[model samples]
Target: SLSLRPANSGKVCSKGAFNSCAECIVSGPNCAWCKKLNFTKTGEQEAVRCDTQENLKTRGCSETEIISPKNIQQATQKKPLTRFGSFVDKTVLPFTNTNKEKLKWPCQDQNVQCQPPFGYKHVLSLTSEHQKFNDMVSKQFISGNLDSPEGGLDAMMQVSACEGRIGWGNSTRLLVLATDDGFHMAGDGKLAAILDPNDEKCHLDRENLYTKSNLLDYPSVGQLAMMLDKSNIQPIFAVTENVKSELQKMIPKSAVGVLSGNSDNVVKLIKDAYSSLSSSVIVTHDTLPDTLSVAYKSNCPGGDKPGEEGICDKVGIGQEVTFYVQVTAKECIKPVSFNVGPRGFTEKMRVTVTTRCECECDDPPMKDNPHCNGKGQVKCGTCRYDCEEGYLGQRCKCSAGQRDEEQLRRECRKDNGTECEGRGDCVCGVCQCHETEGGKTYYGTHCECDDEHCHKYKSLLCGGNGRCRCGKCECNPEYEGNACHCKKSNEQCKTGQTVCNGRGTCQCDQCQCSRGYKEPMCLTCPGCTVPCQKFGNCIECLAFAEGPFQKNCSQACPTTKVKVVDRLTLSTEAKKCEVKDSKNCWMDFTMEELQGFDNYSVEVLREQRCPEPPNIVAIVAGSVAGVALIGLLILLIIKALIYIKDAKEWKNFQNEKKKSKWTNADNPLFKEATTTVANPTFSGE
Candidate 1:
């Protein structure tokens, strides 16, 4: 007769507040139930059976009488390790035909020539005999020529997918890829007009040869990694120094070895990589919700500290390692389970956890308790009224006619101090919500919620696609908006067969373009200048063997056709472009975009518009003549300044003579001069 109750305000596992053992154990992680019948005092409630282990022991409850549950982990499967390991080797060859004399043993011995008509030959399957495998590699394994960046990814996809053809057993599967160059990936098959994507399925012929090599695009890096992990296959890349770093970055949890010039140390490299990978153990866990956090501590060989993501390195065979996992719940949560195991192993250890939330009480109702005015019964310390309808109050003391209206109205009022949130009236200590004109009714205990209040779009509520809850629209999966008006599909944002011409993202039925592309569908780039200037460096590299793209001219401009012409003529369809060369000379070229093709046709003028040779003699003569003219002009300017200064002096002298009291001849200074001369001789005669 156990009953559930809300946890009281106290320590998570304080006093005995639960009745049954299950309820006590579920109340909190620290809580334990006391099974002894005489654990409680005479007046104590039956809920006294629940308490913390320490409190229960302090109260004289024996350890055996306590019930507490802990987190658990179990391993369901354990298979014996297999002895022989399966290996798949992928070799990439250049597109150019090698000379028979210079060709290596396997390629030349098999008489396999190169390039456009390339094919594959499967020589061996997974075998246990080492000598037989070596003989196949030395005699039967023939090299096939393909385009560089080779189809190594395609081969990997096949090896991971076609398990039956490779005869893979229940053991460690290894894929060894030996190459001297990079690999082709998804989106590269478009160059050969292969529109089909890799399906990640077996496409091997009866002879165990990959049949869809040229018919499908190579698998993407992510796809290859996922398939490798799913198949439990470990990849070891033996590549040249050029592509070693790239392969390491592209494939996680994979080993990459740098090969020697002749690849003579491949065996040693493989052995070392295998040893290193086998000695380490990395434990990983499944996805977890945001409320729970997990930490791991392991007794590994290294002095690894606690909470280091469960990594133990330098572990030897037959050695046992112990891991201590700690799971913490940040918030109140229900039971949750997850699996954790070694990174490359298929077996996992399942861990399950349960949280404690509510308490339980087991107490029968007492008949006609006095506290209820003999109109109710007492159960779990609370009074349950059996009075007539409309009775209220804790003891059923108040009825509809005798109810305290002010006190009851307070109970029906919302948090905002409004009665029924102004949507209804308070009656009998409860809210009687009103109905709207549109037939929508108010909900929630305080009548605070209505369906008609959600957002609207185009005069339609929730855009006619979603339901309104508590004044917010909960949009359907296909549509997302404030009013559920925007569709999640991108079909309307596509131009022709491509979405936004592959240059933008579709959002809210509109194209958000990238780069310099413009929208409706991102098909136009109005700011792109002349074709020659746009692809000047590529054209310069391809036509004249010099520019920024000199080393990768083919990749820079893959489909541009260039031809030398005596002179470039402007046509209505072809645009004339003048580009400057490295020598600061303009090279005229007429470029036309071939209709229905992604290539350009260019006619480069044979002669560049270089500046004519400088006329040194004419320059020197012009310099001398200009210097003479400047000298003559300076003399004329000086002569005119002298004449103007002389005329100004004469005018000033004439004006002074006209304004003076004495004439120029009879100067006032003449008498003064005569007097001064006389005074110098005879004192002012």
Candidate 2:
């Protein structure tokens, strides 16, 4: 329900304190001035100086206010320091012990410890120890002997000195570092204080302790915070006002406080810091093994920012807040112990995370394993038993057939003694027969009957006149019975009383025809097939024409100078006539009955005139003219489109110019006009 109202009312410029506009505005954001004509005088006619939006609008100023964002800044709320006397106040309620008596001798005596139920006992103890150590440091050395005043490397070394020794136990761990100047790192500390740079080992009691002053440099704030956080130690910085802001840059605002001189306010600072830190809700993780990971979800008071995971918000006393925690593992691992608590407190809750990747079966037999006659083995929490012959299962007992007998009986198998009734190969617990050479397969769970195997005719076993037994043919008497080779007289192959047309014999009731005939008959001659029928017995006609033409074609032609050409297609032989041109040649001859030729015909052909060449010049001229015409049409179309577009734009411009009221003629003040008043009063009247 908190509200922070902004100081400025969202205006750019305000009143000015100087004459120049730039100088006046730059001087301060509250400065604003009017630039009206001749209004610079401070008298009654001077322009009014405006600092806010209301004032500027009331003055009727022509110029607008300049709103400069660079001059604006969000106001920050500052925390008030606790009273010098008692650090505790109503703003920070005491969740932990803040009584004066309880913290009087902090860490000085063993009896002076944090109250019971405190979250971080070691942290409180460490805070007390830090105070004691600081007291020792103040008393042991003089101002001149403290040379490395800026660096906290020595202080960092002191933190390392308490490492591992600060126990978390049922409490949290806290580390308080009080300084007046910048902290020095390991290499920047006094040479004598640093035993070795490569291997840092400090000699606090010896090795030129006086020269240790100014020999080391301070460590960066980030480095110190990281180191402290790694050790599960929450660091608090109590420093003078000069270095308080610098330290605040490194630590949280709650962890850094102003430290007065002489250590008078140290106690109060520590109490206030502890109260603020412990009161806020926070999440802390215990040391985890390499195989485990943890994540947290917070449902506390304030809303968390993006990327700010695992950070809890503030909560009042007795306010119940829930945090969803998830723990995961990389692989199967045994149970491990880890603690969870707020970072600065001593109180913590211990819990164990266990993985279940392997099964815990019933325990292995102690004396002897009954399964497999004590031969079973244990592996990965399970028992494996390899039973012997005639036995099965983990307990290994006799099989069904062998239970009644004293000795074992072999089954029919190739590996066993029976060998598949001596007819086939044994497979598994049964018999399988070997196939015969003639492809007759046995059946009946052993080599038994083969009634389907035999020489076949027309896809029928034994020509459909007999039965097959053991791969042999047994025909009926009507079939002559020798592998069914003969048939009845009516079933014999015949062609008009002679089988195969007296050219071949009959077998299996069908004719096996001889050469020159197709199957089942000796009737067809393949060589007697006809070739080109247009040329009859072409060789004989060619021979007759080659001898001599009996007469010339002039007898039938009106012109004596005539051309005769003869053509022939030979069928039986590959020959052609060499004669090409003959003067009115003529001949007549009968064709011989040569093979593959049926008849012939004759014709005469005459030559014709030749064709003329193409006209290239005419084609080129016509193409050029057509292309020019198309280009002219396209250019005319584009020009028309552009002209129409320009005309439309011009019309729009004219309409807009008429509609606008900002022209000189419309604005009376800018336009020139004359008005004459007749018979106005004279100067003296």
Winner by TM-score: 1
lDDT of 2 by residue, 113-216 (tens): 32222111111222334455556444431111122234344445434334433323324455566665544344543333433332223323322121222233
- Model 2 RMSD, rounded to 1 decimal: 48.5
* Candidate 1 ranges with C-alpha deviation above 4 Å: 1-139, 146-149, 163-173, 180-182, 205-207, 229-232, 301-304, 358-685
Please give each candidate's TM-score.
0.38, 0.30
lDDT of 1 by residue, 78-141 (tens): 3322222221222222332444533343243445642222233345677766777776566533
**In candidate 2, how many clashes are counted?**
43
Superposed by TM-score, candidate 2 places the C-alpha of residue 81 at a distance from the truth, in angstroms, of 26
Which lDDT value does model 2 have at 631? 99
Cα lDDT, all candidates: 0.68, 0.45
Number of the predicted model whose lDDT against the real structure is largest: 1
Error of 2 at 594 (Å): 99
lDDT of 2: 0.45
